[model samples]
Target: MKKFTVLVLVVIMTLGVAGSAFAVETLDTNDMQQREERQSKASNRFEAMKEFNDEHDQIRVLRIERNHLQIERMEKAGVIYDLLIIAWDNNETEKLRAAREIRKENIEINREIRALHEQVRTARKEFKENVKAGDFATAQIHVDEVIKLLGEINRHNNIKVTNLDEIISVLQ
Candidate 1:
């Protein structure tokens, strides 16, 4: 009887151990599935964010190019204005042509600048919408892009202003 009781207790303990191990394995499998799902979601978000950033950068490049073109247009206008002034002072007949050309070019540049401003406005609106929708990762990317664009604009404007000042001084 003593031997039989001991055998029964040992079997019971082994079953208990096995049951607990099975439960733990089941829980671990479920946990692993949840973790994988989370990782997949995060990866998708990262990819989307990366794509948004790339597109934003491309737009910024185009904006910078447009700004450069605008600066060149302004410089050209300045030179032409100077020529017009000289022609007027010397009673030259080419003053009318220079004046008309400057006017036409200035009008075109103004239109281009207006269009670029509209593009920027649209971008900002979209950025705000993203932020409001809780896509902060994408919104933050847009903010960074804006900062970079602003920096470029500031640098360009500074140089243009200095050059304009020099030209004005020379003319005076």
Candidate 2:
């Protein structure tokens, strides 16, 4: 009976030691899991930040391209105006021919201008639609396009335009 009791006690002691060792390992495992969770969350945040940065860069590139196009349009407008002046300086008949050419060119330019205005109007309409849909990013993109078109129009005319009605009446 004495020997049996000592063997039982030894078994119990071994089991307790094993259990304590397992507990330590379990604690380490839990710590590792918590660290993994934190790392995953940080990775997700970094990915989101990268996506935002990429989108911002794309928008900046688009703005730069739009500005370059506006500058090109302004340069073309200046050339056309210079040609008109040169025609006038040559002679009256040449001036008349130049005026006719100017009128033709102006008509073409006016069409383009009106088309740009229509584009702006359409962009505004789209922006309103996007706003209603809660798509602020798309709305902002449309607004930027409208601003780009407006800049091009302003550079083409270089004149103060207060009232659309008066401008149309005068042009007519």
Candidate 3:
């Protein structure tokens, strides 16, 4: 009778241990599934942000190109102004005609610059709106892109614009 009771108790303890082990395994499986789901969702979010980042980068490039064009237009205007001054001082008919032609070109360049500026303004507004709506990660991406663009602009123009510095500061 004593041996038989000991055997029964051993079997009961074995069953209890097996039951707890199974429960732990089940919990681990559920935890792993949850983790995988979370990871998938995070990946989707990152992919969407990447697409937006690309679009924003393209817009930034367009803006930088427009800014460079504006600088070219300003330079042309300055040249025309100098020619006009020379024409007035020297009473030269050829210089005056050349100045008038440059003025016409300058007017056309000014119109194009204005249109480009409006487009840039629209892009900036959209970027600001996105940042304000709690898309800080994407905004940071845009900020980095703009910083790179500013560096390129400075290199091309050989001068740093204070307004660009202000913009970088605001983004930071």
Candidate 4:
């Protein structure tokens, strides 16, 4: 009788522990599902931000190219200005929001090129005017300024191209 009683007690204890373990397992599964959902949401947000950043960068490139053409035309006309309106326009609030967490220093540098461009335009215009007015000495001063500005811009453009090439190489 004692042996039978002990067997029953052992059986009861085993069943109790197993029941509690099952309950804990269910809770753990629920927690895992919740964690998965949160991770999915975070992943979606990251993907969306990356997509937006890429599109914004494309638009920036287009604008930069347009501004470059304008600069070329102005240079031919002996005009210079550091206008970065193209960069400003390409940089909408959405672009800023999406790009805040990404590597954006290169884009920023390209955008800032506009300011330098405007200064060059001003100097070029003065030089052209001096030349047309037959003020050789004044025109020569303006020419020197133009040369200096162009040199700076050329160096900057070379650096930009090299950086872009490096990035492309890494991507490839």
For model 1, the run of ten residues with the poorest summed lDDT? 163-172
What are the per-residue Cα lDDT tens digits for candidate 3 across 8-96?
Answer: 99999999999999999999999999999888767766755674676667656756775775686466545545655666787777656
> In lDDT terms, how accurate is model 4?
0.58
lDDT of 2 at 154: 61
Model 2 residue 116 CA deviation (Å) reads: 0.6
Clashing pairs in 3: none
Taking all chains together, the TM-score of candidate 4 against the true structure is 0.38
Off by over 4 Å in 4: 1-103
**Using lDDT as the measure, what is the rank order of every candidate, best first?**
1, 2, 3, 4
Residue lDDT tens for model 1, 87-124: 66877655455445535554564465456456556767
Q: Pick the candidate with the highest lDDT.
A: 1
lDDT of each: 0.65, 0.64, 0.59, 0.58
Model 3: ten consecutive residues of lowest lDDT: 163-172
TM-score (C-alpha) between model 3 and the true structure: 0.36
Over 14-123, each residue of candidate 2 has an lDDT whose tens digit, in order, gives: 99999999999999999999999888767655654454465446546655765776575566556546655555576446445544544565566677878888997898
TM-score of each: 0.41, 0.39, 0.36, 0.38
Model 3 superposed RMSD (Cα): 15.2
| Model 1, TM vs. native | 0.41
lDDT of 2: 0.64
List residue ranges in candidate 3 displaced over 4 A.
1-48, 112-172
Number of the top-ranking candidate, with TM-score as the measure: 1
On the 0 to 100 scale, the lDDT of residue 30 in model 3 is 100
